[model samples]
Target chain A: MQIAILSGKGGAGKTLVAVNLVNLINLSTYIDCDVEEPNGKLYFSSEYNKKDINVLVPKINYKKCTHCNKCVDFCRYNALIDFLGKVKLLPSLCHSCGGCKLVCEFDAITEVKEPIGYIYQGDYKYHQIYGGELKIGKESGIEIISQLISKADKEKINIIDCPPGNGCSVMESIEQADYCILVSEPTIFGLENLKLVHELTTLYNKNIGLIINKANDYNNIIEDFAKTKDISIIGYIPFDKELAKLNSNQQLVSDNNKFKPYFIKIIEQIKQEVDL
Target chain B: MIIALPTKESGEKAFVSENLGRANYFYLYDTKTKEGKSFKNNFLNELHGAGVKTAEFLLKYSTDILITPRIGEKALEILLETDINIYKSTEKIARENINDFLNDNLEKLY
Candidate 1:
């Protein structure tokens, strides 16, 4: 079963939950789909095999071109335009549809592969780790996230750390996930973002559980939303200075005596829903 | 000669849009005839590549020169490909910049 850990915004302990869960589960695959800023590899460092993620962008052969606007009109992305009787192509905006080549009767268009990011695989302590890295200056990492998710080991219990927000990249990360774990903090901003993620999970019809970071008894706003949505509150990582200090140094706090119960308690609830 | 300027609206108070891509209207002035016309920027609502699209939209006017308060690299690249001489708009008012262009008071942007 694939479980996706998501947050409405960054720095909401999404990675903390995912990293601890993987360490406790042991013999599971950890796929980090946050290509833009994937730091999960730090906690699971080993000899990693890197593969480049590539996408095709159109290039125009200006020498053999006519002034026909068929290619420009056919492009839904508007990446191609007519300039001074010559065609200009914006590679960043191109979706690699290749319709421009198809519409070009003069055969003035071709595709070139551009390396946008990398897919890295490694293993440590009986856990398989995977990460996607997008190159600097690249506009979108949605493609890399999609390709990385496809590499997950289906047979092994997979725990995916999805990118933050309810955007295209986040949607791609959760496409095949069987269960969605929404993480939030105890603030109004966290509640608002969590609502969006909850709505998204409902739209995808996936079983969802909520983990409240820096949670306290007085955070009624976050508690109220989860109750209304009927989403089970699975776990909470309280606002504690010692735990934060230990986490920064130890990386994995699942084995620590204080945090073990909170991390372990959610396993039964997850298994019951996942197995069903 | 035909001149093109990115304008927020038509009339005396019409100012050059601070942003080239989001301009609501473009004012075209014919130097020989001394007549000006305003064309609605077609891609003002486009979420992406609006600046480049606006540059392409201006090609239909057979403009000889373009004066704007500011322009980005992508839009500047497209305009540079054509024969249009791009002049940096020194004045905020659309008509004053046209007068500035006529008087050769503006500097050419590479």
Candidate 2:
């Protein structure tokens, strides 16, 4: 079963939950799909086989051009602009639709592969982990996330750490899940964003449960909201100073006897729901 | 020579729009004939490349000068390549700014 851990807002402990879950499960494959700032790799000590994630972008061959300006008019992205009586192409703005190549009877435009990110595969303890990191300034990483999820070991249990927010990358990561775990903190902002995530998950028609991280005085806010929304509150990790310090030191708190049961309970809940 | 003025409205009362891409309308004034015509900036609502597309649209007028508040790099690049001179608009009023540019009172951007 493929399980995705996601949050509507960043720094809400989605990585904490996902990393802990993988450590506790021991046999599941962990895929970190947060390409923009993937921190899940920090918690694991493993050697990875790296692969570059590439996307096609248009390149102009001025030698083959007739200066007809058809490609400039055909480009919706404004990547091709009429410059100094010649057509100039901006690689960053090009979406690689191949429209310029199609419209150009002179065959001036051709597609070229551009590296957007890299995917890394390695094992952490007994479980395999896959992570993607986008090159700085790259706008999109859905393609990398999609490829990573597709390459998952279907027979083994998979836990995916999805990117934050309701953007395209988050949607792409969570869409392939057999079940979803929505992580949120105990704050008004957290509650509001969690509600948005809940609505999106419902739209996808997936079985979703909530994990309340940093549970403190603000627990009632999330508790009441989850009760009203009919969402199952699976686990709660209280705001503990020791746990935070341990996390900062790259220690797995799930290995501690005190915190192991909470993660184990979550696993039991999953096992009951799934045939794992 | 034609002068391109960024405007919020279509008539003589039109004020200069602060943003070139989001301008509601563009007033094209023919300096030789002393006649002005206004057209809606159709690319105003576009999500991306509005500035570049707006510059491309302005190309049809064969404008010799542009009077506006500010222009970004992408738009400036396109405008410079087309040999259109850019003049910064100090006044909020479109006609007054155009007069300043035509009278060599406003500062040229490039």
Candidate 3:
């Protein structure tokens, strides 16, 4: 089963649940779809085989080209600019739609692969972990996430740690999952944002359940909201200083003998829900 | 010549906006008539290529020059395709800057 762990807002324990759950579950493959800031790999030590993720961009051959300005007018992105009777290519603005290539009569335009980010494939013991790292200043993380999802082994259980927010990147991650683990905190802000995640899961018709992290004095607020939304409460991880200390040191509570049983219990409940 | 100045407000008393793509408004001043108008820059919130979109928007005014704090390389390339020239605005009110521009006191930004 492919499971995606996501949260509408940041700092609500998405990484915490994803990493620990991946460690708890057997025969699991972990994918960190948070390309902008992927910290799930920090919890486990593994050497990554990095590969560049490239996108097709236009390259112009001005020798055989006439200054017809067709490609310039055809480009909706304004990637092809008219420069003194010649066409100038701005690769940054190009969406690689191949409109310029189609409009060119002289066959002056050609597509070239440009690197947008890097994907790291690493192994944690017998299981596997994949992390996508988008180059800074590049706003396209959905492409990398799409590439990551395509590389998933359908035979093994997949655990995806998605980026925060309800943007296209998060949608791309959740779309590939058979089940969703919606993690949230016990605050008004958390509840408000959880409503967005809940609506998204319902809209997509994906099997989803809620896991409340940092469940301290505000448990009633989260539970009440989940009850109203008709979303099942899978489990809760308390706001413990010891766990916080271990997390600060880049360690997983699931790796600890004492906390392993708690995660196992949650996994057992999830396996039954997913009909595994 | 119609000159476009990035401004925070929609009037002569407005200070110049620092960034062209993210400016609140573009104040247009006609050198011959000394009349001014303001256009709300709707491209400020765009995730990408706001500069190019803003430059495309300025084409409607037949603007002869642009006076802003700075323009990006992409925006400069786009604006150069038209007749609009770029000039850097200094620490002065919008009205005074327009006067300085008309009097040829401001330096061309190229």
Model 1's DockQ score: 0.52
Per-residue lDDT of model 2, residues A1-276, tens digit only: 799999999999998889998998758899999999888988999998999988887777879988899988888877887765677776656676888889989877788898888999998778998999988756678889998998778788899999989888888988878899999999999999998888889999989888899999889999999998898888899999988888878778898998888888888887766666
- TM-score list, all predictions: 0.87, 0.81, 0.84
lDDT of 1 by residue, A126-228 (tens): 9999998988757799889888888778778889999888998888999899999999998989988888888889989998898888888756778888888
Predicted structure with the largest DockQ when compared to the true one: 1
Ranking by DockQ: 1, 2, 3
Clashing pairs in 3: none
How big an interface RMSD has model 3? 4.0
Q: Which number leads on TM-score?
A: 1
lDDT of 3 by residue, A121-153 (tens): 998977799989998756577789999998788
After superposition of all CA atoms, the RMSD between model 3 and the true structure is 4.0
lDDT ranking from best to worst? 3, 2, 1
10 residues in a row with least lDDT, candidate 1 chain A: A267-276
